[model samples]
Target: MSDPPKGPRVILEDDQPQIAPRLDFGWDQAVVPVVPPNPPSRWSGFGRAAAGVVVLGLGLGALEAANFTAAQFTRGAVQGWLTLGVVVAGFGLIASAGWAELRGLLSIRAVDRARAAFARGDLEAARSEALRWAGGMAEAAPLQPALRQVGSIAELRALLEAGPLAGLETQANALGRAAAVQAFAVTAISPSPGLDALVFAWRGVRLVRQVAALHGLRPGLAGTVALLRRTVFDAAAVAATDIAVDAAARALLSNKLLEQFAGEAAAGALAARRMLRLARVAAEACRITPPR
Candidate 1:
């Protein structure tokens, strides 16, 4: 009789699925790694102005010392009114440059604190800081609307959390675009290039804060990654704006230095669009309304 059919040979191959190694890129992590902000570039307009003033002052001092006689060198008697005027102007420019740099540093710190607050789950603190930041523009009567728009972001956050998602995207798009345009208007009326750049930086910070608030997200490595990604996509526009603004500032000493306003405007528009996209992603990810 034929032997009973042998059972299928036991195949002992290792069938365990391989797992991929974890990457520490900061994405998909619960804790966001904080990266320090880069120091301002030496090529910045303010830096150059400060440097030039220093050189001018040193050159004037050397010339005065070399021509020194028994009599003390008085401002009026040293050279002429032009020399005295140059000395006074150099001091003023240096002071202004220092002040601008200080303000920029302060602004960066304020933004960092706000981000940290949100990351720690203190939404109220985050909102308060943002509102305070927006309040800065309330001093100018013309900027009241922009201030209101900035303040109204809280309402949008509420709506984003509770309202239907059907038309929310449209609302986000419109609001973001409007805010950017308002920023442009405010910058256009700035009294100086220093002030224009200051306003621009503050508005960008506010926009980022507003968008972060909308999704109940905070400043963390993940958010930073998102921002970097958005920036990459719009780098050309942003770079063009920087070049235009710098060239304009360096070209003239007048208030109407931004001859290439169109490029700056385009940059603002692109930034706003990116902010809207960011809010959308955050809202979709969270799925539920954030804590009040």
Candidate 2:
């Protein structure tokens, strides 16, 4: 009688932010697992040494058994020793390189574990892990206020989830400060220019992906690239920041450039702050929540 029941009854509810499914924050563990290319085996070094010893022994035995002149025998023995020395030196170099590579892998693994802890909402655990690597540098004086306000990983998640625009701005501010300290910590722990670039790139990429995920994006290469493009090209503020950060990080990490400590700190802070802007823009574009 009432126009076929006017379709189904519709109920309206107040608008609110819904808690989206939590994303796994173990990005480093997933992407930067502790897997260094295996160095030449110790056995190879041992074999080289053994071969060198055997060659020396054969030379000595030949010199003792032969009826050659003393000069010829001495010359042959010298050549054998020279060969042995070369082999031994090469082996030493390989061993040194292997040790250095292993140390680098262990350091990266430790960083990954700390990042994983942070992802899983264990701020204290994450902080402790970073402290172990950074030896108090992770908690620089400049970042104390931001860290206090952030309180915990859960609080950060809430800000990402349902907090207002102001909340997102606050989150950005806090995260920017935290990231600055973390970058300094990273550089303190690893002084290599190439290694710093790689580590910071990983950190930056993972952060972008995490924000996208918070806004319901699947973590994948395509999404990450797209969001990065958008952040770099669509948002003027973010784009400007990106340009500035890129220049700073380049200066900070350039082996050819003699960089001062103050310059490095400034570069790191600016890079981090810009990264937060990238995250915010990506999240907003992804529509993590309804527009105000």
Candidate 3:
């Protein structure tokens, strides 16, 4: 009988590990494209200014006629000039206010564009626009932070995917030195059944991280990723032949503390935090690291 097609498939035929994880790799534009939000036209401010000028001019003209005609007297050229200046001044004030609002509109457009890029899996584009939106907060003393952290997540994920590393993940950093070393594999030649199980789980956790980071999950979904990362590493640590690999992945995943970042608006931060912590501890049984 033939085996089912639903079985395992190798994503990459080449056994390339010397390359390491990509941290600086540019985003894959081939990934789905996100529809960017419309950018506000600079012309909007001009339109508002034009409208204000017309209205102010008309209003001031009417006032001048009313004052002169009601008193049955024509004002001198000096008075006429004074009235014209006042009308122009009023129009200027209105134009300035409209320009301010126009800035806000343009900013919102940038944010929308950023969000769209992220959805499309264009991480580079998303990160670029996200930084712009974040600057909106600085420009707007609006007493509110309207933009979501979705952009920030996208930027972070893109950085991690660049395929370069130095330190460790748990350190809230971009690199990690080798904490230890171990020899392990998934071949049938392995000595222990427990080792097979551990290898499978360890690989599984790495898969989860790869997928999660690829998607740029929001805080709501981050917990689920955390759950998977911690769980797989824990299992791998205990069941694998190499304790170092398990310990290192565990240390790295734990350091991110995605749960701890649950903010006042974080709906599931607490739950994620608790679950991630418990899962990391479960990895304790697999620990090969010396007491810290």
Using lDDT, give the best candidate's number: 2
Tally clashing residue pairs in candidate 1.
0
Residue lDDT tens for model 1, 54-108: 8888778657644542133454465555555565686678667666556544554
Considering lDDT, where higher is better, how would the candidates rank from best to worst? 2, 1, 3
Q: How does candidate 3 fare on TM-score?
A: 0.26
Which is the leading candidate under TM-score? 2
Q: Which residue pairs in candidate 2 collide?
A: none
Task: Show pairs that collide, candidate 1.
Answer: none
User: Candidate 2's error at 82, in angstroms?
Assistant: 59
Indicate whether candidate 1 or candidate 3 has the larger TM-score: 1
Global local distance difference test of model 2: 0.56
Q: Tell me the TM-score of each prediction against the true structure.
A: 0.31, 0.33, 0.26
| lDDT against true structure, model 3 | 0.41
Residue 160 in model 1: lDDT = 31
> Model 3: runs farther than 4 Å from truth?
1-77, 136-292
TM-score of 2: 0.33
